[model samples]
Structures are given as structure tokens and as C-alpha cells.
Target: MMFKSQRFFKSLQLLIVASLLILPLLISEEGLNSIISTKAVFKYSIFCFIFLSIHFLHRYLLFPKLYARRKTILYFTSLLFILAALIFTRPFDRLMFELRPKPNQVDAPRREPPHSTENRPPMGNERRSGPKIDVLSVFLFLIIITIEVIIETNKQLSLTTQRAISAEAQKTEAELSFLKAQVNPHFLFNTLNNIYTLAIIKDENTAPSIMKLSNIMRYITDEAGNEFVSLRNEVDCIEDFIALHKLRLGKKTTLNYEVKGFLDAEKKIAPLILMAFVENVFKYGISNHSSNKLIIKLAIEDNILNLLCQNSIYPDKKDTERSGIGLTNTKKRLDYIYPNKHILEINDDDKLFTVKLTIHL
Candidate 1:
């Protein structure tokens, strides 16, 4: 489609040039008659053929092979050689002179003063008049070269821009993949630790916890690699995560997990985005000696989704700098996928830690 449009534009430009070349001859009756003559027709045909051949030769061969390859001296030298050849050939000189109408003869001959021998200018009929075909040919050649140079320069710039954009996109994808790889293993290690605790105690729910781990792993394997997942599926994963942690919660520890608003299957979110905060709650907020409380709420209204996780901080189970890998990667993922579309706020006080996240879906 692009090639066809370019060809059409080139044809239109050539037609306009041809029309301008012949316009002066079309103005007078005798000039019009000269145009229809067999000799004049043959001359114009040859002129047009030569003009088109030069145009195509420069566009496809000369410019691409020499000028585009940085052979500047050679390219201009070739153009100058072509210009000299056209000027010496003088192809349109006779054709233009023949098409010009001859001046009308006077009915009575002008009578010179009998005694006046003063020199007088020659009559219009005796004067030599013709188009400056060499000058015109040089001007036309310069115009063609100028146009080709501008076009090729613009084409190279556009190709460079496209390549830059492609490289940036690939870089972004690779970074996101690396971040996700870091997150998945970190998540698996924590879940396996929980299962190990249950197995040591020989709790009745140990087998069920293992089964839950299997389901969670299956979801991660199947859908976590995708850029977005159904919001409904993500919510289900969060519920399973909470259930698995409940088995290991101390009697004094309290967890209130609630979901408000309708969850549409059509709505989607970045996979594993919310899990990091949830995992942190279990890691650093649980205690058997101290009374601990964890509150998690997710609400959706209109196209906005909000998550709030507030937990009582236990000094003995408090997270260290090295244990923040999941949250760090999650923050990076949000910047990559959501950019300015999401807001996250974390507040840590002596007694409590709170996380608030809002996303524009």
C-alpha cells in the first residue's frame, strides 16, 4: 500500500512538470499548431523519456549506492558529469525555438530618414530569439538532486527511530521477566517452610496444606507468567494463601480478611501483584506470646481497585532489611506494568504496620 501511494505521487509530480514545460506554447494560436506537428510531438516524447530515465537512475541507483554509502565526492562528481552532458546535448533548444510564434510583418515598410545615417537597432524579425535550454536543463537537474537528497535523509531518520523503539521494548520485557523470576522462588520458599512446620507437628491439616500448595503452584505455573490475569482468579489465589496461613496461626493471633464489591471476570490485574503484601503480614505480624491482629480488605468501585492490609507489629517477628525481597520486586513490577496508574503507600509505626494500594483498572 505504501509503495503504491509513493508511485502515484511520483507520477503526479512528473505530470505537473510536463504541463509546466509545455504551458507557454499553449498560449498562442500558432504555438498551439506547432505542438500538434509530428516533429514537435517526437521532440517532446524524447525529452520526457530522457527526463524520466535520469530521475529513476538517481533515485534507485546513484543515490542509494553512492550518496547513502557516504561516498559524497563521487556522488557529486557523477551529478556534475551528467549536468555537463545534458547542457552540451541541448536537446530542447530547437524544439522551443520552433514552437515560438514569428512576429507579424508590417503592411508598409518603415521609411528611414533620407539624410540620417545614425545607427538604429535591428528589427524584431532580424533578431535571434530562443530559449536558454542549457540554463533550464541545469536548473532542472539541481531541483531533482535536491528533492532526492531530502527524501532519502527523511527515510533514514524514520528507520532509525523505529529501531530505537524496538530495542527499548525488548529491554523492558527482559527486565520484567527477571523480576518475576526473583519473586516466584521467594514465594515458593516461604510456602514450603509453612508445610514443613505442619509436618513436624504431625497436624491433621498437613496433607490438606500440601494439597493447597499444589493448587497454588499450579496457578502460578499456568497463569503467573502472563502479563495480566482475571481478577477473579487472583482473588481466589489470595483466599487460598490466607487459608494455608490460618493453619499455622497462633491462638492469640487474629486475622480478618474481607472482600467488598462485585468481582468481574472481565476485570484483570497483574499477576502476583497483591501477594507480596499478604505474605509479609504472615511473616512479620504473627506471635504466640503477644496478642497480634491482621486486617486485610479489598474493595472495588467503578474501575478502581483498592487493597488495605494493616497488622499489629510483633518486635520478635519483625522483618529485617534482607527479608523485603518480595515487596521490593513487587514495587518494581508495579512501576513496570502500571506506571502512574497505581498508588502504593506503606506506613510503619512502633505498634503497627499498614499498606494501602489503589489501582485504576
Candidate 2:
């Protein structure tokens, strides 16, 4: 949706600019046709074509290679040479417009008596011929150059603004990653401590717990560094996290994990984006009683990721120290990366904590 909107606005901007540029041509054609002959209008169009060719070349090629690179001497020199070439091509322009009288006619005998009603050919001096500089062409050349410079300036400004926005987004993402980095070690230490406790007690689950921690750490080290990863990977990570917690809490906790609809590995989402809520469920929802319950549902339908997490909370068992930090960082990352492409809702009452997130892939 964000990309579509950006593309639409760019297309609209180009359409508006094209319309504005063509408006003058339409006006000139109509006004010139009314004031001058059709042949004169044709000459005007050719004149415009020449000016456009020069404008495009200078704007796209010469300016970028010379003027934009601060080669002022070469740039000015080339522009002067172009102007001289146009001035020297006046004879060719006149020939193209069929404005030149025949050379033979300049020295030929008169076609009719001067007093007769018949039309007479123009005398040699009456027709201007050969390399006559056109002031109008020069005027139009200057106008085109000025207009192109303004357009180029606007284009440069737009590019600069886009670059600045991209840089700021990268900076924000870096900050988010740093915050997320802090959470990784904290979670890892807690999981490791659990494994150590199991090892000290000589529990059979200790070896498997170490293996699970290793797998989870691999995912964290590899996928967490990226801005996005496959949704399948995220799901697998969540399952591993749930399994790890199950080993720790055992029969004291009940975790209901359900995945509905087809999962596409091709679809991607931000890494560690959904895990904070999953981690929160185990952190606060785990209790040494049969009544403790954690429900997690991940559904994919029509390229949308719907994640729903609900966990039972007791008044005296809350861990408020790390409660909001992960959620805060996750929200900031969502705003930075997904922008308008996602929806997140959190509901917390006395008995339960619920989080629902919808992401458009």
C-alpha cells in the first residue's frame, strides 16, 4: 500500500509536469496559426524542435558531465561553441524554411514590365540571404536554458530530500536494532540460567534445553540482524521459544499454540518483530499452578499476518521491570519499517493480557 501510493504520486507529478509543458505548445500553435500562415507555423514548430533538442542534450548530458562537475571553463566554452554553431547554421535554417530566393533569379532578367498588373520577382537586395542571424532563435535558446536550469534544480532538490529521508530511516532502524540487541542478551541469560538450574539438579531435560537454546541463539544471531526475514522462520522461532518455556515450567503451565491457514515461506516480515509479545506471555503468564494458561495463534490469510496472543495474568506475579521496554522498541521498529502497512492492538485488563497484530505483507 505504501509503495503503491508513492508510485501513484510520482506518476501524477509527471503527468502534471507534462501537461504544463504541452500547454504552451498548444497555445502557440493556435495563436500562431491565427496570426500567421500554416507554413509559418510549421517553421515555428521546427524552431521549437531545434530548441528542444538543445535543451534535452544540455539538461541530460552536458550539464551532468561538465557544469554539475564544476568544470565551469569547459561548460562555458561548450555552450559558447553551441551558440556559435547555431549562429553559423542560419543559412541552413533559412534553406530548410525555404526562405532563400533562387541564386539564378538574383541575376536574371525581369519577369514582367514594372507597370504591368502581373506580379514581378523580388530584386536581389529585396531578399535577405545567407547566414542571417535570427534574434528570436537566440531569445528562445536563452528561455529554454533558463527553464531547464530551473527544472534541474527542482529535480536535484527532490533527490536530496529523498536521500535525507532514507538516511533518517536507516538511523532509526539502527537505534531500534540497538534496543533489540539489549533484549537479546537479557533473554539469553535467563534461558541459560534455567538450563544451568536443570543441569545442577541433574534433570534429563537439561541437554535438550541446551540444544534448544543453541538453535534459538542461531536464529537470533542470523535473522535478528536483518530488517526482514521469512515469516516461516519467525513462526519456527516462536515455537522454539514456547517449547523452551514448556521445558522450564513443565505441567504447571498450559500453552495452546495453533496455526491456521496456509503459511507461505515466500512472505517476509521484520525479524524479532513479534517475539517480544510471545516472550512476555511466558515471562508473566507462567505460574506453578494448573490454572495458568497462554494462548498463541498465528494465521495467514490473503497475504496478511494475523498474530493473537492471550495470557492469564495474576496481580502479584507481574514483572513490571521489562514489561514496556520490549513493547516500546517493537512499536518504534514497526513505525520505522512498516509505516502504514501494519496494525497493532494491545489489551490489558486485571486478569489477562492480549495482543493482536495484523501485518500486510
Candidate 3:
């Protein structure tokens, strides 16, 4: 926008320069005496202004592409030089010089003057009988035009660059928002898996777990994208995740889970945020289940959620892969979305794996 304004001012400035320069040359007595009468000079100035204005306007407005290239500048400048030279030589110069009074000797029958053999003055006219081509003025005019063209080109380029930058910023923001949305769908997929497992085992806890999952999903669908949610709502989501995990395990496992303090269920997190530890336990603990014993503890103090869970190691003596999607994705989201506001600790021994998560709401 600034460039556009500059271009407009420059164009208007050049037009005013042209008008001011040519105007007095038509109206002044000295200018009229040197060439044609005032009326003819006025006509000439008007013709020159109209013609030049049309030429420039056509190139700049109607056919910008035509004047945008360097070759066009060279072509127009050369054409203008030729036009100026022709204006000097045309018969209009002879008629204007005839405005001067006849010589005093013309009363002696105005005899046909003999052609001079040397560089002598003509019979009646002075040394300069016609229009003069001032090369300096023509050259200066061309230079001014060239500068104006360059300025206009720069203004256009600036406008184009600004638009490109704005578009790129919008695209980057859209991509980041999309990646954030992907995390919610990931949670839903895991919940669906837990529900399917529960049906297979015919667990009595399935209905309640399903209801909790639905509520957590509602939080995700409606509110997770906002700036903040209460710490209480986040704890509710964690409880729901634990409930579903417990339902899938059924009577085959013994689980201890606890929460202290008045946990408000309105706290918000990045929706579906708490499944990381719950999923990790089921994958490496209950799935192996040498004894099927697990302990899950949660507490809230001073607006913080502290989660602790431990379970027996996999029975097949296999080391659980830390690179699995559930843990790795959770780790990334935690660092990206929670950053210094959250803490996570993992400990594993020959018999058990333990995880502790502390979140500053």
C-alpha cells in the first residue's frame, strides 16, 4: 500500500512538471516572439501534451505488459527523439519565423535576393530561421521518464512480495492447526480399540467406561481448541481413561487407583491428553500379566495433577519398545503443548514399570 501511494504521487508529480514546463512556453511574449504566435504555440503545446499523455497512458494503464520490459523503454525514448527532431524541421518553423517584420530595404521593390556564396544571413530572417532541437532538454526528459518507469516497477514488485509473505504465513498457521487436530482423532482411535477389547471379554464395566469415553470426546469436540480449560476437567478425562483401561482388563487384573483433594471435573487439557500412561501400562503390563496386579494413583494439590501408576513387567521377558506411537506421540504433544508446565517420569525394574506425571494446571 505504501508503494502504491508513492507510485501515485510520482505519477502526478511528473504530470505537473510537464504541464508547468510547457505552459509558459506557449503563453509568454518571448517564447511567442521566438517562434510562432501565441495562438499557434498554445495549439502546439496542447497537441504535444495530449499526444504524450495518450502514449504514456496507453502503455502504463491499458497495456502495462507492453511497457514493463526494458526494450519498451529504449523503443519509446528513441521514437520521442525522432518526433522532436521532426518538429524542428517541419514547415511550421518557416511560418512562425515569418511573423517578424519585413526588412527596411524591402520598400525598394523587395528585389529577389541573390543566394549568398558564403555563410551569410538570409534576405529577411535571422541566423536561426526555424525551430531549434535542444539535445540537452530531450536527453533530460528521457532520463526522467526512465526513472519514473523504474520506480513504478519497484512499487509493483513490492506489492507482489507483500502478498506472497502474507499467504505463506496463513498457510503455516493452517498446517499447525491441522496437526493439533490430528491428536484428538488419535485418542478416539485408541478408545475404540479399548471398547472392542471390552466387548470381547464381556466385561460388566463396559457401559460406564463407554459413557466416560463419550464425555471425554465431547470435551475434545467442543472445547479443547480454546485457550484454557479448568484443571478439574483434565482430571476427569484422566479418570475416564483409567476406567476404560480397567474395563478391558476385567477380573483378570487387580488395579489400585486413588485421587485426593476436590478435583473439579471442569478442568481442560489438550483433549484426550492423559491416555499416555494408561496405554503404556496396558501394552507392557497387563498384556503380559504374570500376576495381573497394577497400582494407579492420582491426586490434586495446589492446582496440580500428580499421577502415579505401576504394574508387572511383560511376561515374555520382552523389553517394551519405547518407540511405539502411543508413548512417542504423547511425549511430543507434551513437550509441544505443555512444555515447562508438565513433568513426566518413567522407572522400570526387573519386576515392574512405573510412571509418574505431574501437571501444573
**Who wins the lDDT comparison?**
1
Q: At residue 238, what lDDT does model 3 achieve?
A: 64
> Considering lDDT, which of the candidate structures 1 and 3 is the better prediction for this target?
1
Candidate 2, 27-63: lDDT as tens digits: 4424323325566556546554666577668866877
lDDT by candidate, in order shown = 0.75, 0.70, 0.61
Model 2 scores a TM of 0.51
- Give me the runs in candidate 2 sitting further than 4 Å from their true place: 1-186, 200-202, 250-252, 287-290, 314-319, 323-325
Using TM-score, give the best candidate's number.
2
* Residue 99 alpha-carbon offset, candidate 2, angstroms: 42
What are the C-alpha RMSDs, in order, of all predicted structures? 15.3, 13.6, 16.3
Model 3 poorest 10 in a row by lDDT:
91-100
Q: What is the lDDT of residue 164 in candidate 3?
A: 74
lDDT of 3 by residue, 1-361 (tens): 7666766856765674566445434544456454445755565565456446644654465335556554677657655665575456443343333433335564665344697335443554346643366433454355545655666667667777887787567645643554354334534677788777777898776677688888767766676656566666766766776766554565778888787877676655654456557656666666533457788777877678788888887657355444323555566566666879999987877677888888887
lDDT of model 2, residue 348? 84
lDDT per residue (tens digit) for residues 1-361 in model 1: 4455567656755664566456436644576686676777787777666666777888788888999999999988998888888888765554555555544476675678997645543344554444445666666667666766766676666666776686568647654654455344544676688889878988788898888878777878788878899999999888988887776677898889999999999999988888878878877787778888999999999789999998887666664543432676678778777879999999997688999999998
What stretches of model 3 exceed 4 Å from their correct place? 1-210, 265-268, 315-325
